[model samples]
Target: MSNVTSGDRRVRRHLTAEIKSSLRDLRNQLSMLNRQVGIQLDLKDIDMDCLDLISRHGPLSPSTLARRAGLHPATVTGILDRLERAGWIARERDPADRRAVTVRALPDRGKEVYRLFSGMNSAMDSICADYDEEQLKLLADFLRKSTDAGLTATRDLSASGA
Candidate 1:
């Protein structure tokens, strides 16, 4: 039989609760940060999400971006127009398919967005400095696993019609 005692179980529960609370609160804090960034840049929430997607995995087709962002193709067209007008992104012909177009974030314009996120990035760097290489690796692994779990849960929920 297992040798686990009640006191150990209580401590484990407390630790798990604290970690869960931190995770939930962190999501809200990140959302707030994004909102502030959006406000300063005069962009919408969906625009920020789409922008990040393009910046990270870009030179993507507008249709691909719309699918990823869960926005309608017509709506994406308006957003692309706005972003182009604001000098945030550019639309270029897809070399592989001359009839199609892809969107790309402007590197020079990206610097402004990074500038706004610098505070959080610096703080994260400072936090990482407190951990040794092994510990940091463990944390990174845990985070990656957690993200995979979240994606699985999201897919399951969608399948369940939730």
Candidate 2:
């Protein structure tokens, strides 16, 4: 019932492969960048990720952080311990929920971490400037879809004990 031909299918497959390859490269590069930033800050990769999450999402409970970071609650506790000790994050008692504590990134420390990526941010801005609004919208949509796919894959793998 479809008019799609073999050549069209092959082209689509090739483009998909290219996209996957680029995503892999981008992930690897980001991991390397995170490691470099961690070393510069004398923090572990997970610590950096935790700080980033708090910086982006504001205060979050430990359980919420664990879910967001794809980490076990025990592991998140350890990360929080380190971040707290380093003055990168602070735990505050939730006013409405006395029993729950939320983690927040220290403003100065968050700015310090972001300083490391300032150049990359500028470069990304320049790259975006090369595209027109319509093209940029398409790119944004693709990235959002890709991120959702990645999150789903992560959940599936975790559930499967992989």
Candidate 3:
């Protein structure tokens, strides 16, 4: 019974440690990728948090985007103005709420942005090529979990006024 308990403890400890280490590794890797992606996509001067929120959540209200990006509404409007002028994005009245405007990514410009970063992205693809489909899926799963955890932690920290 004692031996079984000892073995169980070891297993639990190993699993926890592995998870912690993996999360750290993923965070570091993503930080590097974020830097590269910004440069490659010509988003270096663009506020990435805004771009990320817009990309993931689809077209957003200027106010919503500002809140999510942690920027003032005026700042978001200014950024949107620049993006619109650059032909990379557009703003149109929201169908459900004609008073509200939604900003959206133009597909052509989006493709161009992706094309610009294709080289670095290709390198990332090559790195993933060594992994089998199952391993790739597992890695993706971990990535999602890590992102969720980070978001949750951020929320909690903010709520606590940290």
Candidate 4:
């Protein structure tokens, strides 16, 4: 029905496979990078991720952190305990809600973590500079869609008890 030929389909399939492979490789590399950073910071993977989330989203309640991290509230409690013990974060009473508490990142600890990633951030910025505005916008869109798909797959797998 369409004008596409067998050769075109084959090419498309090959490109798709390559893209999948590249994405997997990237994910693995990022995991390894996180692991290395965690070790350097004397923190666990989840601990580092928690710090990142806090840094990005500002102060958050334990329940919100657990939801964002895809972790159980009790599990997040332990993680928060560890982070608090390590002096990376502090638990503060919410000013607007006296009954609630929120976690905030310690400035010095956050700065140290940011310093660890400064080189990588610089490199990524350099790479981005090579792309024009249109190309950068397209790349941003692709990344957003890919991230959403990944989150959906994670939810589906978790629901299936996989």
Model 1, 1-162: lDDT tens digits are 289999999999999999889999999999999999999999988888889999999989999998777677999999999899988999999777899999999999899899999999999999999999999999999899988898788768766977
TM-score for each candidate, following the candidate numbering: 0.89, 0.95, 0.71, 0.94
Q: Write model 4 residue lDDT over 10-122, tens digit each, in one string.
A: 99999999999999999999899889889989999999998899878969999999998999999999999999999999999988889999999999988888888888899
Q: Predictions ranked by lDDT, top down?
A: 2, 4, 1, 3
Q: Write the per-residue lDDT of candidate 3 for residues 1-162, one digit (tens) a residue.
A: 655787799999999899899878977986786777667665644555566567678688889898776677989888888777777677899888899898877777667656756777899899999999999999899879977888788778877987
Q: After superposition, how far is residue 32 of candidate 4 from its true place, in Å?
A: 1.2
True lDDT of residue 26, candidate 2: 96
Model 1: colliding residue pairs: none
lDDT of 4: 0.92
Between candidates 2 and 3, the TM-score winner: 2
Weakest 10 consecutive residues of candidate 1 by summed lDDT:
153-162
